[model samples]
Target chain A: MRPIPPWPRLRRGLEHDYTILTVREDIVADPRTGQEHPRVRIDCGDWVNVIAVTREDQLVLIRQYRFGISAVTLEVPGGIVDPGEDPALAAARELEEETGYVAGRVVALGSVHPNPALQGNRCHSYLALDCVKAHEGHPDAGEDIRVELHPREAIPRLILEGSITHSLVVVAFYLEHLRATAPR
Target chain B: MRPIPPWPRLRRGLEHDYTILTVREDIVADPRTGQEHPRVRIDCGDWVNVIAVTREDQLVLIRQYRFGISAVTLEVPGGIVDPGEDPALAAARELEEETGYVAGRVVALGSVHPNPALQGNRCHSYLALDCVKAHEGHPDAGEDIRVELHPREAIPRLILEGSITHSLVVVAFYLEHLRATAPR
Candidate 1:
């Protein structure tokens, strides 16, 4: 691997605040050219995606209308991690809040930048196994979410067939699948 | 699933422009509350991710410093899809430009929203098999990228062990792996 060059940030400022997302502009000195260039960065808070698996080996999923794409997308239960909240706790909270499921065990899958090229936030993924419906789902006021459960074996098929299209959600399931199938 | 609600956009305007990304604000009527809300949208062009595989069964990967995170990341060959350029063509072009590898076959794996909650662009993923290095890589003026190749078999381990942590890149490889193992 090549050494990481110094990308010096000359200045940064919040350009716009839209509650959920803040747009920031940064002037950085490009390592390759030694010239300053302005770049836009979206500062969305850290998010959590939970692959909650039921005792029956089913995956707790959600179908919701994404306003950006204006389409109902099937994805794993997840949401933004509230300020100062632990990612694992956020995962558990989102799973229960979005699907009414409680996980017996919450394990970290991994975290990744949703889009390193532009967005400045980490999306932490988790595997919540042995989930059970403990209460009625209580989605946020703006969220019209439908909870669904599917056999865990059907996830790959769903992804391949284009049913699950959220990149971070797909990654959460992929990590869970890898851990489940790894040779001991 | 509930019928898709009408998310009527009342107004939209560019909030800021920073070369690579343009920030736009949209006033839309919230479906659940019937109240207008201001949302920031990052207007990045559609991007492409390529899983370029050599005849020797190696995956072409790149190491680059991401300015937003200020960390070196190991990701598959990819870049922004030029305006009016086909995603497949952009995938092939990015592979060649970033790694000097040309694929014999370029197949669409899938497309996903980088951040459905905010970003308004799709990232098209592709599988480029039987790739061969035909020329030297030509990274852009600001990009200092290093190309590397790894055995295809090591991809799952790399992903599971957290070597490859870019969400979109992981999704691209996951789709490829699923397609390769699916029932014919």
Candidate 2:
């Protein structure tokens, strides 16, 4: 397929800084008709999520209250990847911090753009095998999390039944499924 | 499992309106300690995407330039659900408008929160069985899209090969897979 030409930036507009994300506006001209339009862009740090499984094949999951949704959600351990930090190490750190699960081995599964239409960040997924509890979890000041362990086979059912509804979490499991089923 | 209590809103801070999304800040008190903290929230309309398959079993896909990533991306046809519009109907409308494909029948696959930590919206997925070209697509003024068809079996490879990197698209395909493999 031929590459789609990108729009030319006309000027930069206002920018608003939130703690986790920054919103900015850019004026750009369409390549086809040269029509100018203002597009909103969200700048965020790359994120990392781990599909950590125990030696007994139990999946480590977390239930936390998300402020945006105003409710608790079931998701994998994840957080923003620190600046200049390796995504694999970030994945391992997040896993251990959120659930106290230390990984025996960590490997990258894949990555995806959370929302390329408005966000410029990637969320990297990792598989942490043979995980075991190392210490008490240390959630952030605003975070309250409960860790749960389930059979790895129940992931598909959890997702299908809507118990797990975070898009990034679902993508992580999907990537893990692809890796497990791939031809060696 | 016990339910996690929600934080109480202390006050509303500021709100900024963007064309596609609205950003606002809310001051809320933690349930455990009553400590107040500011949280950023992004308000967006619900969204819908269609996994359209032709009678010949070819998957309908589209390539379009996303301003957020500043590049072209391979994705399925989708758009924000209009106010009071049924998500299934919106899915069909988006499919027709973005790719000019009309579905013989449409069924709901499932839904997921795009980001419950920051965005309060759901992205609903649908399966459009037996889709066919109806007319030339009519994308929005800022949209320029190219439609392509691929065998349904190639989706996993496309995703794994990083040709399709949108989180919502990956979630949609994962939901379809769960539906296809569910025991009756």
Worst 10 residues of 2 chain B by lDDT: B1-10
lDDT of each: 0.85, 0.93
Writing each residue's lDDT as its tens digit, candidate 2 over A19-138 gives: 788998899898999999889999999999899999999999999888889889999999999999999999999999999989999999999999999999999999999999998798
Chain B alone, TM-score, model 2: 0.97
Q: Which pairs clash (backbone N, Cα, C closer than 3 Å) in model 2?
A: none
lDDT (tens digit, per residue) of candidate 1 on B52-105: 989999889999878667688899999999999999999999999988889999
Which regions of candidate 2 fall more than 4 Å away from where they truly are?
none
Q: Write the per-residue lDDT of candidate 1 for residues A94-119, one digit (tens) a residue.
A: 99998899999999988888877777
Root-mean-square deviation (CA) per prediction:
1.9, 1.1
Candidate 2 per-residue lDDT over residues B95-154, each given as its tens digit: 999999999999999999999998999999999999999998989998999999999889
TM-scores for the candidates: 0.94, 0.98
Q: How good is the docking of model 1, as DockQ? A: 0.65
